[model samples]
Target chain A: MTLHIVSKSPYSSSALADCLRTCGNGDAIVLIEDGVYAAQTGSEKLQDFAGKAVFCLRADAEARGVAVTATVDEIDEARWVALCTEYRPIVSWFK
Target chain B: MKFTLVVYGAPHASEGAASALRFARALLEAGHSLYRVFFYGDGVHNGSALAAPPQDEQDLLGQWQRLQQAHNLDLVVCIAAAQRRGLLSESEASRLEKSAANLATGFTLAGLGQLAEAAAVCERVVTFGG
Candidate 1:
């Protein structure tokens, strides 16, 4: 099974970075909640994973009034469910 | 299939804990079995016995207890992290001669080996943090 990571924590950024370092070129990184902040458009850290599918929550983005500039797709609750069902990813919710 | 949840955030500091709780409920409702819930790093604070939120706020400890009892969940608090944060069980508290043990019931102290075991046994190990 492909491990799905919702990189949402600032603390786990290093760990997330560590995780992505081993990306087999088929994994995805969904930046939800506070994780959207990590995708500051042209951030070098986020650049590596841009080739993979990157997602952010639309509600969270609007709440923060920050436009996600990365190659990030938007996900709502229904879409979230769909992704989970389709991928059955091992979700890592980072704060 | 079996899954293990690693909670890495405090109960109130962020939504990580609440989200994890919600996901656990969803997983159970969807007919999935949980092997364990490992509390690591700042996540151990969620199991502290001294936390007292406002009256309206969800009693996190109570919620964890309820889920644990109902699901017979194996809750493990990382001993290294707990000690660093001053969270101890009754025995550890007494052995260390601390004022008290803040670890709640339905949870036990364990090491990183538990994490490795979870990784090996469970089909997926989900982590909630930040």
Candidate 2:
């Protein structure tokens, strides 16, 4: 298992693309920092990975003021730690 | 489990390197081992030996050097990217007729095969970028 952290905005960075191409099931993608931009409501790119678990860091989302109502989970730093510890993922792609 | 860290951001440009460094330290603290840290694209800048930060500030380059020294970490900078960016080693600098070379002490110049090998060897491959 592995967790991919997408730290760049979706429109410009190929982070999401790399994650989709290389990541397998039982993996996760966390949108943090500028990556939260990809989690906004109605993100077309996110549609493809609807089956994968998508998470956004609450701190980054609140700081960036990105409004979203997607079916994704908003996770805090504590949860982030928990996710890293729990999954112990095999790969994390950031862009 | 062993982990591989790929850095695709330059030092002092964004929070990517700092964040990755912090996460690497944390992973080590958690008793995890790092297989390698691959620097590619703009990330090759992290190995530039010319960086000189203010005395009062935390020199990130020095931080990486210290971290690698302490942990015996594998710091691999892409040869293609480094050459393109003019980040030459002593030998490359001399061969290319450059006056100086400043790639960091701990980092090595390797090919993409290192990245592929890292993927094959490591249990986790985490990337840090812009």
Candidate 3:
């Protein structure tokens, strides 16, 4: 499975949306840097990621003062590395 | 294991390129074989031969060139992205009627298919940039 990492904000670019379109069911999406904005409550961007596995970097979320929902898994640096090991073809979407 | 790196950020302007460079170095140090390093989007700027940074600052373009030479690495810049950013090779400059080409040494312009092929064959593909 591919691990799609989106580090750009949904507001600023279509990186997240573009990632969702190509990512498969088994693929995972991890939000980092400005991408933590998409994990905020009531974000329309969250709706697009409804059924897929979504994750947010814990450091990024805390830095942005955003709360991580139950639906989104908050991962640390070690967990991020673990995810990379578990998955292949780690794709990063940014613009 | 064979690995591929896809970079999407410009050098110096963003941390992406630096991070990728460090990671690539570490990967090699750890005995991992790199299949390719694909530059896409703004990452194409990393291949500009005209970039002249302050003498005191790190020359990221030069660093990449040295790394490519030392490792015998395949450094590919996406043709579509490179063209969009006005980074041209000798042939591309001739074809487009541009005055000169500024693509840095050790980097070649290719299609996105190269990325696809790398992803398909490499054991892992890591991306750096946002």
Best by DockQ: 1
Sliding window of 10 residues with minimal summed lDDT for model 3 chain B: B22-31
- Sorted into a CAPRI-style docking class, model 1 comes out as acceptable
Candidate 1 backbone collisions, by pair: A8-A94, A8-A95, A9-A94, A9-A95, A93-B127, A93-B129, A94-B129, A95-B129, A95-B130
**Candidates 1 and 3 compared by DockQ, better number:** 1
lDDT of 1 at A91: 54
> Model 3: C-alpha RMSD to truth?
4.9
Better of 1 and 2 by DockQ: 1
User: Candidate 3: where is the Cα deviation over 4 Å?
Assistant: A1-83, A89-95
The DockQ of predicted model 1 stands at 0.34
At residue B118, what lDDT does model 1 achieve? 90
Model 1 residue B16 distance off true place after TM-score fit, in angstroms: 2.2
User: Which lDDT tens digits does candidate 2 get at residues A1-95?
Assistant: 77788887778878778778877888888887788888887778767666898888877788888875467799866566457766765354554
lDDT of candidate 1 at residue B74, scale 0 to 100: 93
Candidate 2 pairs with clashing backbones: A1-A89, A1-A90, A2-A89, A2-A90, A90-B124, B49-B102
